[model samples]
Target: MNLSKYLLIGLGVLSLHSCDDFLGNKPKGYTIPEKFEDYSKLLNSSYLMSSSNTVLAYLTDDLYRTSRGEIMNENAEGKLIEYTEFNFSGCDDHERNLYTFKHGQVLTAGNSDPLWNNAYENIYVYNAVANNILNVPDATKEQREAKYAEALVGRAFEYLNLVNIFGNHYDPKTAGTDYGVPILLSEVVGDGASYVRNTVAEVYDQIISDLKTATPLLPEVATNVYHPSQTIGYAFQARMFLYMGDYENALKNANEALKLNDELLDMKPYTTTYSTFGRIVLESNPDETFPEDVDNVENIFMRNLNGAGSGFYTAVVASEDLLETFKRHLAPDGVDMRLRLFFATDEANFTMNPSATPEKFKGYSTYAPYITQNAGFTTPEIYLIAAECEARIGSVSRALQLLDQLRDARIKNNVHYVEETDAPNRTEALRLVIDERRREFAMQGAPRLIDLKRLNREDWFRKDIVHSADGETWTLPANDLRYIMPIPQTVLDFNPDMPQYDR
Candidate 1:
């Protein structure tokens, strides 16, 4: 009963369909195996499919916060950029940064950039493995079905992230009219490389259809944290429905994901010294080391981007804006120490990177290459998503329950609970929930954008956001085209048949 033997047989089964003749030449000093040798490489690629290294993962944060402003610096020179034209609001206060882009001043394309290219590249590899599994020879019926389900679920998750950033939200009545990304189901090369965009509806339809078909086929869990199973599928389904405004389904799936997995890590177990972000980092809880514990009361699916060298972990400080907001909202008696624990305060004699001149804060370009603590989505986020869906469905109590589920874990000593009186009524409660989400998820980045979009507050989002430093205000205005970034121009150039995104 050696499982190794069975694993090898399984790998053998996986290889027959994955070997691509197109990879004819091995790298220098590398020998081309006669038969497909590393089936696990395909599995590994899916893990890397959406890491911090990929443009798809990191750029989402950059576009949303666009400004380089530090809310903590009262005398910080050069406020974050604000485009004069609402569509270009994030370009810069001067408007000089506007013209270089293709549409809405969003970055168009660059010969040297690989962010967009990497996303597409990931999609291709996933699709290849999926297709190979589907057509694999001599594979067991159950094994093949499981592999197919994994591939479909994995690919669908990739596309879900893709559409959120690259295409407009699905407008049920007009998705067909909106532009989405090109649907590259199979691998292509040479003259056939170019592809046209798929209609937004078509792109989502494919994702929904694929998930629908693959959901039941997936397992309850997988040995590798990277692979998809029933929980990931449900999580994605919940996320998709939330994006679609299908509140009922969103609520259902969100709860479903919670049921399949509900293990929240309680930070209260730690002493006050290690309670803040700074303390937590320097003196981390043993629990923090194994972040992917599915039973981890806070995370659903986390991309493994751990270290300085590839295949390692890198610690990141909370962004300054987020840091200030946390400090501003600091409970008078001080309850939430996560801010202090999560952010680095070695700025005593700190000088901004010379390149970040005028911006005040160092942009990613000038900052050292390390993973931000806020980079990947985490488990507490699921509770937030569940809370949002509950609020949207007018279930204030349900939403409050979810919030409590999250807050009870973080409300510092003696104050085992902080009764949220702010949630006096349903509407106020909903808004409070959104506000709490902003604070809880703070620098993490997903909930804020989703909250703004869900509430249709894109216009007043920034202006309404309080700045602790100066009462300086900023606004993103409603229906501002900038809210939806232009689909990468390279996408348009490659797929001329696809219609351009409406400005």
Candidate 2:
């Protein structure tokens, strides 16, 4: 039941596979999980896999500069550097050294940064669990199958993220030609072998295949939000389908997830409080620390970041544009519950050592476990996707209804539902939906960037996205190759044939 027990057992399982943790330590002998329950515990351990995606926010448009009195500390500056130029596609063309990195070179910790390394490591761990759990001697057939299903779901989610981040955006025309990430299905046992990149289509097929296989095996409910359930699997499918531009399947999966659990957190209660961030963790009580209190009706599956210290949650100060946009749409009063509750009035203030009273509007960081920040895949996301789907199929009224459902919950006093009249036609309705989507998922980071990548392919959603800080501006045009990150140089060095995405 304890995490420590699972940690040792997890490490023991990992040792058997000759896997390396983030800490570069010599391999040691340990026992494999003989019981299915032990493998279940291993799955629960944060150390066993990558907990949350902290780095995706950096690649997003949600971040902006905050002018402050004190000089930024080294850590803050480092983050700013990486935030500006880590995309690797346009760094060479950019002004001002384009952040601390050279063009075409990715930020690295051993091989790549934590996001890349942790993700692959997570894949390795999931592979270990899936390949071994059902064979455990102490479990019944049904229980073993259920645990095995969990592994597949876990593996599927990571691969879904991996392919999207490293591979080019899903294009029927080019996915076959586009390079995807290195697919690591099982633990690497031999002296390290070279890996050629999989095509984007192949990787997508694998992700879909895993999700399809795993969904049927999952229970209706999970032990916790961290664990995947049938509903979570459906949610994952909805997201994948949405990404693939398959509006019909996206709608189907989203509705299925809603049938399982549909709840929306009222934003009214949080009007005067902060949401979550981890920049300054100085607090008298552990409970009062980062991630104040964000458990709400909307969250479908809530796995967050598992790293420490001013983690990805605190990376970006909320941009003024997002705040202004929220104010403009939420009400004429220009004071939304989202703005009041989550963002600080003096957001631009940057102190070297922030005060202990951090509950004060800590920007868009959700009040999550200080150890982790929730990368949301909440029910509202489904609502948004459904709205988008409806808008796509010429259901303007239906799309607005969906937006109102979410808007009514977020806007204070329940008066500000987005109306169909605001966008009378399907094209206009889709535009409204796109705007709402950006506002809804502003601080979360992944969706806006993802939306940009996919939506930009169309002439309608094609607007230049500008990311700026300290007088430097990086303007991304529609469907830029920079959207697709370069595969690591180490990956290229190992397999020379594994072509990098366009620089």
Leading candidate by lDDT: 2
Cα shift from native, residue 482, model 2 (Å): 1.3
lDDT of 2 by residue, 108-211 (tens): 43344445555666666677678888778887887777778888887777777778777788988888988887766755334345566789888889888888
For each candidate, give its TM-score against the true structure: 0.69, 0.79
lDDT by residue (257-303, candidate 1, tens digit) is: 88887767665554323222222321345434322234344555655
Find the number of clashing residue pairs for candidate 2: 8
Q: Could you tell me the lDDT of residue 113 within candidate 1?
A: 23
* Number of backbone-clashing residue pairs for each candidate, in the order shown: 20, 8
Per-model lDDT: 0.50, 0.61
Shift of residue 476 alpha carbon in model 2, Å: 2.5
Model 2 accuracy (lDDT, Cα): 0.61
